[model samples]
Target chain A: MIEPFTVLSSRTVVLPVDNIDTDQIIPARFLTTTQRDGLGRHLFADWRRDAANRPREDFVLNRPGAEGARILVAGRNFGCGSSREHAPWALLDYGFRAVISTEIADIFRSNALRNGLLPVVIDADSHAWLLAHPGAEIGIDLRDCTVRMAAGREAGFEVEPFARHCLLNGIDPLGWLLSQVPAIQAYEDRAACRA
Target chain B: MTAPRTLFRKVWDRHVVVPETAATPAVLYIDLHLVHEVTSPQAFAALRERGLKVRRPDRTLATVDHSVPTAEASWASGLGEMDHAARYQVRTLGENCGRSGVRLFGVNSARRGIVHVIGPEQGATQPGMTIVCGDSHTTTHGAFGALAFGIGTTEVGHVLATQCLLQRLPRTLLVELEGRLGPGVTAKDVILGVIGRIGVDGGTGHVIEFRGEAVSAMSMEERMTLCNMAIEAGARAGMVAPDETTFEYLAGRPMAPQGEAWERAVVEWRELNSDPGAEYDRSVTIDVGALEPQVTWGTDPGMVMPVSGRIPAPAGAGHRKALDYMGLSAGAAIAGQPVQVVFIGSCTNSRLSDLRAAAAVLRGRRVAPGVRAMIVPGSQQVRAAAEAEGLDRVFRDAGAEWHQSGCSLCIAMNGDRAAAGQYVVSTSNRNFEGRQGQGARTLLASPLTAAASAITGKVADPRPLLEEGRRIA
Candidate 1:
């Protein structure tokens, strides 16, 4: 089971670009390993590295005071494109606990929730505030379903109840499904009998 | 059962193993689970970690794409020119599939190809089925009246362990095309035109049901080309009602039922359409009769314009960023933009029909002096069919590389890529920045458009070239 996600308080790393797709999060070339660990090193590899594989100093993650930022404030349509879970795995491995965006792609939102990495969709005004004040302190509370900024401005967000329950209780989706083996087998057996 | 219901309601209702409650989602049984090397390794590893065996290995089908090279010798060589990591990933899938008891269309198998292509080709994708994979384009199967969509690896693991998925109900959007397509327009152009009308996130939280005269008139492969880009429109999936054409495509295939069962299946499939006056949550209508050939002049699929039109002024931040990344300015004609690379493959349009159309354009012509082009068959079956029809000879004689069946240059995970700062006219979906390669600018277009661009070395219209069809032979 992944770590239980409930309340998270931290400074944020801002990337003010729309449609930041999974390809930009982790390039296809770095997706070879079967293991999920160590992917944090390659998160945003193309944007973080130069032609010679040296770290680009101008990148948001590589700059000073960017280390250990546990939240990401990104633009709209964050995590679009491929359904690669490597995108969220890399994000969580890179020390992000939550992502604040104006919009998030469907499959990516599901993937992030399963991994206990929160995907928070806020209003445009709140998102603009986060974009303007880079490194702003913010708090996310699953109990209240709201995000609180440093300046007392806040916005309510939506999350599926079951996904929220699993994240709230450190419950894994596969584990829950495994517990329903009898029901699944019965369904199949009935279909087989019909055939 | 007599109440009016949408097509989505029909398929989704039949697959519910356990209904949703206030707290949990419906546990839907999947009829087919298509797997690939890129997304399934971790899923198998997770099963091993949990000491779990595959609940229904019979329903799962795996393949080696996204990581395997497409060189002439690569299939037989096993390791071929693949780097250490690529070779490792391919081998891992083999080991995983072997230990899990799932059937794998390995690198050397004649049935191997892009996951989407081989499924329909083998008849594993059929009417009234609920299909899924770890790739976003799994919506391609919805052409056969199936309720299909992509899932992430975590859900992949869940399905592997139980042969089921937990999902909330998605809203239905009826996208109706009023009339038949124009001469030069194709399934790709129709999809592009729709995505351009609705922004990328317009279909978010909904599954699109395509209905009308144009959809009814298209072939099964053409319907697949239209549905394949549903994800680009941020749709959960895209669907079309099954008809006689769908049954004809599935008949006599190895995986399809024979004799009495086939007749019974057709009867049931006939009832899979939306009833008269069934309501959808939302609706949109487009007139395909007057549409022009479409092309993406920016970074995303929604930033598209007709081939005969000029790029429009940016309306917001997203369009501005797209134009900046594409190195284009407003009011410039999308035509005459030079391209260095041309790719004509992917799940969107790599069928035999697509190959024949491209070959028809390049029949007695040659690729431009500086343009590098490649035509990757969607599957081994497609490659063999093209070879038997002499289409491969046409492509090679016209100076395009006739690559083997694999996802080459589309995802670029197999060491096939356009160089930095190069312009590429591609038939694949998703022209996101760095999707083809780092700093590569991709213009998404129909296979016919891509073929014409390869000949002219610039973005060009395909209608005139296609109208010049009778001159050959």
Candidate 2:
């Protein structure tokens, strides 16, 4: 049910804060429905709104020229806490095609990739450059696995080749795994016989 | 010949459905798959959309936890005062489980509890198994020597369709704790001390094996508590070798093997320890005797200090921000800091033993006048056991509310929250901003420390209070 992703060029929203956990991305209270569509409205709900339901002027998403940004440039250890897939759901629902960070939590990175949200890990210099220029256009070439800043500075990153193949083909791993059922059953049978 | 194996390698290698090749990660077969309401709804929907049946429904278990109310009235009335959206998720879980033919412990079920607590209590967690849940706290099951970790919703759907996960191998780290723990110090303190020493991200991309004398001396519940916080330390999973203590705990549980099967399981479990010549990618040791009752002073679990210690000076911008948010001054003592609430419950420390420990401190005492203290048992079974022993009476007489089981106040997903700016001493893990409630300050501690703080309305140590009671007796 995911769209195949290959190349994306979009302006980046800068959020230069480390350890921005999944809870911050999408608070637990907002994780009410199974449907992933409406979650974009609640993304960063706590940080975006005051207790009185007024929008916070200083929050990055509320600032001017922050709309329609498809790439998020964040700090280190992004999406660090909780195994809530709601975090990535909110990000993708909000139109973020990719997130660039110096580091991403292991679980979050896996979740993002499986959901067709590209998690781009760049060097400190590239991260700093993106953060320094808010609303700057950045290009991600999934075919080549490279990230390019608007100034033509580029960084090559690594994504698991299999995950890349799945994303490029828009294939759900379950189908592939289902095809390997015979092999799985064989392994189980062999292990049981040994036992 | 293969190298000698650490506990992690031994268990991980046993679960490999397909070995890692040039193009794909290894396909690891899961022995148990725990599902909760919060993360499983989408996964079930995904299955429905694809017209796929749950491949191994027998291996999967479901429960409603995060969105369930802990109040007895809510259970009595079916959905009393519960929000519409929250009730929808729980109801959907029941419907999904019914359609998928997977067993679910509904809100009113006697077996209902936090998924992690129910797994061990029912003996679903076993040695040398691969367990997956859509919850990070699934690491708590690793205490049984299972290679358990949380996965995302998509992976949850994949596991439901095929009882296998594609995972790359993780490095192993051996965390050894030598010497005996001092009186009043609990597993929570030890883990807090470990996280403080290692920092939050120190265990990234690794599986940690907790070994040595202190870990060996811990009870099954204590071991679970230690492994539960491994995620807080950034480890993918944490495990303790299954010993006689582990077997003893699993022996009579409902799902545990019996008779000949039980005997065979024990024989295999006994061999689960790390080989003598095994090598860990990293190893560190801590002297348990040197630990004290520890508490978090800031927003994260890593910003911890001993109860007897002073607040540390800010070391960086993060530390300064944490201090400012906590409303604490550097160099000031944490002992007399005022607390408005004390919560004793969570998958981390909500077992029968945890309740008994807190009850011991609350007996013949009353909660301090302005503090709202509550004890939510980990499960329905734990609640029944506590009431049989009159532990609930002790908590009630001491002015603490005794509530039914669920993850209450830990993540505050079910309308259970502390007031903004209020300082709370909680027995649950995670002190992240607004984890307890929006703008609330949480100090993570053990049940004993939380009970003591409830009585004094401040951060107080339980050792002196316990010893004083002994002297009076």
Candidate 3:
């Protein structure tokens, strides 16, 4: 059963830097296995490893209150490099329901929506505000494309109408097409000529 | 009122078949189907499970890339290192393609490279065609005016079963690239610059037709690099009109037609260009010469600036929030900043040309004392070609670690990665926060720029290094 889009639990996880690729999201070493399981444990393979190759407790994800955090308040260009769906799969599997960023890589954005991960794009200033105030919970209303803070501050965003429709219904592009009977029927009628 | 139609819609509308009702699937005729090593295993297994042959094998092409080792020594050990299960899956893909009579560019084939690379080089990526592969970068084929997108394993099975799948056409966005590309700036920078201008989600719901002199002048490889990253900007797909450069690149390839047939193919291809005065739902133009060798300052590709520029201050709501989260101050110059690591490889830029370009910078120079650098080839073929020219030696001599290719450090799905809080200069695409490793700082740059940065132990412009190379021009 598809899950309808709803307000996601949003909060900023501050990293304070740039150019983060998938390697950091889920390290390359974990890719050797076919199983997608256990990836959540090794999300930041190299960085999380200690001098003796143990998990580093200082990592944001390893720190207090960050475990299983739903909303990822991240830096610009949220997903870049490699068209791996696994990056989103890892993020989703790790319990992030939404990613708020200033920008994203083209492929990562597509994969995100298809996998049911909502990527919200906010302006730079808003991103900074959220970053500076960690644990500041935010709410994203998909129907309105608005992200609001608990403090009553709100920002309107723009999402493709089609994407918005799909998100609200928890349907992908193909799934959305499946919902439009008339258009599909028209297409079928036209396609009957080729048959 | 009738809206102006886009190429994607026209092509999509022409192929969609009606289902039993609106909720039923609209069967779409797929013109080209590309397959690679990682995702085809299960698709083949399902066919065998059903005792079904691949439908429309003529439209299907397969290749081995990921998991194929780059060097002979590595190839042997890597193959040996693969668990029995992984080996079985790879062999199954090859055997199934063979039994189904699908053209398979296997490990030993000279034509084998990245699945995306093989398509356009061989003219299999035709205009007005809908191409799909299980790999997400399949969008790379769109550069030749095709409507290409990636599918999952289940969708792969559907395409194999019907030679058609369900899809709706995307709206069109015209992205015009004007002016000239500056020296040392390549197609990678062009796409990066686009993502930077539009932000990542700007092209959602649209198929982008890239135009203007800058796009027209790019080689098919360069064009593929551009279109490949379109998905990064949230575009459904990205394409360029077929032109002489397209035809020339297709000529003489193994799968491409010869002589008169080729001429006929070109005649048809020439007509694939968008009509004059075609309307786009949205259009944006970029001046190319104004672009410098770009580098990602924040995690996203659009969080980028000229190599000489500083990290942009968070201005808009999103940028500010992202910067605050990233713990970076606004307007910090990225140049001359120390880096602990550097990487060069990915579907985005790890081709022979990118390696050669990086080598030109690293040939005689050594990486900074403490900085670690890694060079990974995009495919086995690229590795072979690089080794043939002794590029590997050049990389090693400069204190760079060259690894067996399989989406290394690019995604950290393999053993390569950076420590937390470590700063890196990488040639791979995307710089999303925590992309290289959680809490690690990623600075995205061209391969040459990455190499130069490695030598200087800081983010540095590649132009000076290129100027020092007498043969670069």
Candidate 4:
């Protein structure tokens, strides 16, 4: 079991960039550790940190008001490259509980959901509004599957029921699959019989 | 019972262990799981923490890549080139696979290579199978008509505890490539063209089946190249129907069925293509008769144009940001830009054929004085095959660095990287900022283009060079 992700209410940090790939989220050089902890420091290692290994003050994450923001508002096709769960690991560890975009890549969405990071795909209007209004208060309720923002504007998003249940209860999907061995074996046995 | 089914549906239907419901995903049994040093370490750690043994060791295969240094050719030194943490990740994978009874082609093994390359190299990938890995390019196996996709470490643990993944079926998108492909237009160009037509997110939440005469005519390796980059278009997986080319390539591989079993397998595989009248959620057709060799000018693969084209001005802030990261001016010619390095290896284009293609261009022609060109074969096997053909000598004679096989410079790990802010013409899959190195600018292209760029020390079209060879012949 992991941290239950039922609701999140926090100001959003806007990085209005499209197709923010996993490499940009966390470069491949930092992917050596077998463990997932301490990755928070390396989230967007290249974008957040400058060439001299100093934090660039211009980046949103280093700015004063950006502290404690839990929602990330990015452009379309966020998380577009590499299936490294490190992207979400770094995001979650760095205190981002949700990423809002108009289009979230397929594998990244699955990875994010399995890791308790809500990949919120909003409508173009809601996405545009979110991008235009960074630091705006937004609330997410996994039960209703809605992302509620300022001025009563909200968008309904989709999360597979099983993934939603897993996120809501802080249950890892592996345990559920582990419990269904008999079914898996039965299916394999049937294939053998047919063969 | 008589309804037509897509090839993807056929594969997905056969792999179902338990059907989906309102509260649960379908239990999809995996026939093969490819593990590499970088992604599987954490997944194995999770299994060890839970005291769970791998459910089906026979179906699981492991290799060391992404962290294995291409510079280290001696196993006796034993991956000594890797730093502490990278070495630890590889060693942990070795220990975990040893304890779990899974076969690991470790850094010490000659068969070691990129996970995607050796999976097919070993014939572990087959038609009508369900395949998964922790790397997004697992779609490479779909060239064999398998239902393959990448998963996260959590799902990797699930497959370890049970050789099955809980997945919601993805909708199907049919991409049909017709017309005659021109010279110097390899599979890499075809895929880049597809991604250019369809935006980066065009195939989001879908599995794409590449169909038509152009796909039918492609070699198995070429098809792998095409399917390998479907992820660049946000596709979960990419597929091409198994035919003569597929079976012919699989016939003598290590794990393929032998003799009578192979005959029976062939009979069954003959039916693996989609049936007539198969329904699809979406369809698109691209005419490749006039298609030219393509190159990516922007960071995203979708931001590409023909080799003779100019970089388009930014349409939005996202495009502007990509242009800034790429360090290219708007309206500038995509060609003739200075380059410091040229990389000709990745899961996308590191096969023996890719090596041969690059060697063909590099033969007798020296890489420009300032350019540092590196040619990394996709697998040890590919390296051996290229060496057998004297391809390595051609690269070396052309002033390129010939290295051992691994995902070198493609992911920018293993110290195989270009310096910051330097431009590189690479034959890898992604061109995201800091991908080849911190602050490095990447212009993604095919092996031929990379070879030409190495010779010119700048981005250059390969058509004239290729045409010269053909005309001489």
TM-score of 4: 0.98
Off by over 4 Å in 3: A1-195, B1-5, B18-26, B40-53, B67-73, B76-112, B315-330, B363-373, B384-405, B419-421, B437-440, B471-473
Q: Per model, how many backbone clashes are there?
A: 0, 0, 60, 0
Between the candidate structures 1 and 3, which one is better when assessed by DockQ?
1
Cα deviation of A8 in candidate 3 (Å)? 13
Give model 2's TM-score versus the native structure.
Answer: 0.97
Q: How well is each residue in A75-163 modelled by candidate 2, as lDDT tens digits?
A: 88888879999999999988898999988888999999998999999889878888899999878999999998765699988888888
* Per-residue alpha-carbon lDDT of candidate 1 for residues B302-401, written as tens digits (9 for 90 to 100): 9999999999999888789888889999999999999999999999999999999899889889999999989999999999999999999999999999
DockQ of each: 0.79, 0.69, 0.17, 0.85
Clashing pairs in 1: none
Worst 10 residues of 4 chain A by lDDT: A186-195
Clashing pairs in 2: none
TM-score of chain B of each: 0.98, 0.99, 0.87, 0.98
Off by over 4 Å in 4: B72-79, B471-473
Q: Which stretches of candidate 2 lie over 4 Å from their true place?
A: A191-195, B76-78
lDDT scores in order: 0.91, 0.90, 0.73, 0.90
TM-score of chain A of each: 0.96, 0.96, 0.82, 0.96
Q: Please rank every candidate by lDDT, starting with the best.
A: 1, 2, 4, 3
The TM-score values for the models, in the order shown, are 0.98, 0.97, 0.74, 0.98
By summed lDDT, the worst window of 10 consecutive residues in model 3 chain B runs over B17-26
lDDT for each residue of candidate 3 in B95-126, tens digit (9 for 90 to 100): 87888899987766767766776676566777
Winner on DockQ (2 vs 3):
2
